[model samples]
Structure formats: C-alpha cells, structure tokens
Target: MPILIVEDDNFYAQRLKEVLMDFGLEATLVNSTQEALSSNIPLYAAAIIDIMLPNDPDITGISLRESRAGYLSGVALARRFRQKVPNFPIILFSGYFGSFEGESWARDNGILFFSKEDGPGALKYCLQKIGIIREVKPRVFIVHGHDEHALIELKDYIQNTLNWQKPIVLRDEPSSGRTIVEKFEDFASSVDYVFVLMTPDDIVRNVKEDDKRRSRQNVIFELGFFYGQFGRKSGRVIVLHKGPIELPSDIQGIIWIDISKGIKESSGDIRRELKI
Candidate 1:
C-alpha cells in the first residue's frame, strides 16, 4: 500500500518520499488540503500531514477563513479524513517549534505528532508504530572482511539454525550501475539489523617492525555507518570478532561478541538476543 504525504514544500516532500522508497515502500504526495481531502483515504496505509499549507482558495466545503489560516489546514484535513476512516493512522508533522498546542490536540485525537527537526528517524518510528512497516522476519545485513568461508558459515547458521530470514551478504565489489557507497546504503536501509564480522584480514607493521592483524578498512567503515544510522543504544547492531583485533577506541561502550570460543557456541547468545 502507498503512504499519503501532504506537504506544500516540494523539496521536503521529495525527501520524505525517498526515505519511504529506501524502506521498500511507496508514497503519494499532495500539495494542498483540498487534494488530500479529495483523495481515496482507504487506499493509503498511512498519512503524513504537514502543519503549514497554503490556502486552498477553491475548496468548496471548507470555509475560506479556515483554509486561509494555513496553520490549521493539516489538522482540518486530518479531522475530515477521520470522519471517513476513524481509526486510520495519521501523523502530523511540522518543522516549527511552537506546535505544542497542535501536538496536544493530535494526541487527544489519536493521531501522532512529529517534528521534522527530529529528522527522518521520527518518520521511521511512526511508520513502524502504525504497522506500515512490519517486522515480519527480521533481515540482518552481515558485513564481513576477507573471511569468505566464515561469513558463509555465519549466514548459514543464521538462516538454517537460528531460523531467521536470509541475511544480506553483499559482493566485495559494486555492480556496474551504482557506486559501492550507493549500493551499501540501499541494502543497509532495507534491513532491520546489522551483524559486523571483524576478522584478522589486514596486517599492519608497527614502528618496531611488529606486525598486528586487523579487520579490513571497509568492515570498519560499515560498522561506523550502521552505528551512526541506528544509534548505539538501538541494540539492532552486533559486532562479532574471531581473534584479538584492534577496535576503535570510540566504540568501547558498544556490545561485542567474542567468537574465539567458536561461531556455533556463540550463535545461541545472538539468537536469544535477536529473539529468533
């Protein structure tokens, strides 16, 4: 089902649309309250309405004074929509800070209120809450470095033993159409969880000529990207390492599973944590 987005700003509406697409969802954009009110409300999975909108001068049923106010146009449209679909999920969003009154009213009316300043994270949270985004079989994106055999084993255990869906295992090189970063972002955004395997792939020599084993640079980059995208406290991220690998000092507080005991032995802990 497509999501309905009502926003007068073309750029912001397009940005929200991109975010929805990233989640493998579709969206329909409307610029005015009149357009939203006339749409087929039952067709949308959910509605995202912007607080400020231009006056719909030609709207017949709504009063001109009310339409011209702009600030309450979204609220008015939402109320009208509720008349048709009383229990539909509606999210009211505004970048403006002085929206506590509207937010309170929305809460009283069983609608969600989000601030654009909170970024696309707020939109994602609302979508999940309204059942637009389903956590059916949680997909995990596995990022590994130079440990092809170990990576395949982990993927098999996650899918067959743990009974989780097939984990996303990307090729080392990007395909023809897109850059590596673009492909990574597209794949990462679609998954609900991340598993990073830090193996002793790269060897670096110190000033004293002592060599130390570490994970590949790409693996470390992916770990940081996922951490930043889903906050450290999200618990959606897990780092699994084989040996004594050098980790970034900044990620000291994050959880890391030591696989030195064996991947099979450590699999139970991961399965339990993921509720699989």
Candidate 2:
C-alpha cells in the first residue's frame, strides 16, 4: 500500500518520496492539510505529516491556531485521522520542530515523531519500528588516505560485486560553498556503514624513535567519527588497511581486514561482516 505524505515543501516531500522508494515503498504526496483530509486515507498503509504548513483554501480566512493551518497543522491532521480510524498509523516528520515540539502529545496520542535533522536513516528506522519497511540496503561511506588505487578497488568491489549504490568518497564531491565539517556531516549522517582505509600515507616520528609509516591524521579522525557514530559492536564500521602501516591502538574489538593482497582477497571477509 502507498504511504501518505503531507508536506508543503516540495523539495522535502520529493526527498521523502525518494527515501521511501529506496526501500521499495510507494508514497502519495499532498501539499496541504485540505488535500490530505480529502485523500483516500484507507488507501494508504501509513501517513507522514509535516508539523508546519501554509494555510490552504479550506482554512484561508480562519486564524492559524483555530483552523489548524500553520505550525501544528500536522497535529490537527493526526487528530482527524484518529477520529476517522481509531488506530491508524501516523508519523509526524519535521525539520523545524525539535524533540520538545509536541513530542509528548504525539507519544500520548500514539503518533511517531522524527526530526529531519536526524536524516533519512532515522526515518527509515522509524518505519522499521512500525513494520512498514523491512529491508535495508546499507548506505556505504568510504574514508581513505592517499591510496587512490586502494580506494578505487574497494569502491569497485562495493558497487560491482555487492551491487550497492556507489560508495561515497568525500574528496570527489563538490564543496558547494559549505564548510568542510558541514559537507562531511551532510553525507556522513546518511550512511549506515563506513570503510576506513588505513594506508601508509604519512610518516610520523616519536620523541626518540625513527619515523614510522601511518595513516593520515584526517583518516584517523574520520575513523573515530564513524566509530563514535555506530559503535564498535554495531559492525557498521569496516577498516581496510594496506602495507605495514601503524594501526591505532585506541580502536579495539572491530574487524580489521588487510587488503595488502588486494581487495579481491578480502571480499569474503567483507561479505561476511556485512551479511550479504
């Protein structure tokens, strides 16, 4: 069954539709509360309503609060849906509204709330909670040192072999006037899996010891970032190292695949860890 999406922002609504499509789900988008009320509610498996919406013809002259046209329009819509179907599934998805915004009311009324800032993964996770979406194609992010060859091989294995979407490489993406951290988070927040390549890209010297080959500082930073995001036991972060590079002792209890013999040799390990 199709899912109902009530959102005024066309861009955001299209994005939500795409996210649903990725999981082989269909969506019916309605821009206003009026249209949503008129939609065939029984045709949809569930409904995702935006918290803020503009006033429509049905409530044009009425006050925003009284007519339920603005900020809490989704709340009003959810009430109406519940009135029609006592146990209809409804989710309130919003970018402007935080956890404190009508969250308590939603919980008390049997409605799920998700913040867009948490990214599409969180929305899908919510869907999984409600038993709407069951399958998940792991979104892959690649963090690598200066080893372009290793990056290409691993990307090829992920795309061609695993048949997953092209793994995201930060360096290849456009900056688009955003800060490095902003750009990183824009991509990183969407991915569930990470592949950090610890290549011998840098040489570091200790207080009284000779210089030893190690992964770049940026690579290590990204590794830690993803590790913190997914945790060690989540099995979402994969570390691929080449050569006799000095590995970080701080990271423990995670699978480390050696690609010294090329990415092909470690395909079995990768597949086993990813369970595909």
Q: What pairs collide in candidate 2?
A: none
Instruction: Give Cα distance to truth, residue 163, candidate 2, Å.
Output: 0.7
What value of lDDT does candidate 1 attain over all alpha carbons? Answer: 0.80
Candidate 1 lDDT score at position 262: 71
Query: What is the alpha-carbon RMSD of candidate 1 to the true structure?
Result: 7.9
Which parts of model 1 are misplaced by more than 4 Å? 1-134, 172-176, 208-210
* RMSD vs true structure, all candidates: 7.9, 8.7
Regions more than 4 Å wrong, model 2: 1-118, 123-131, 134-137
TM-score of each: 0.57, 0.57
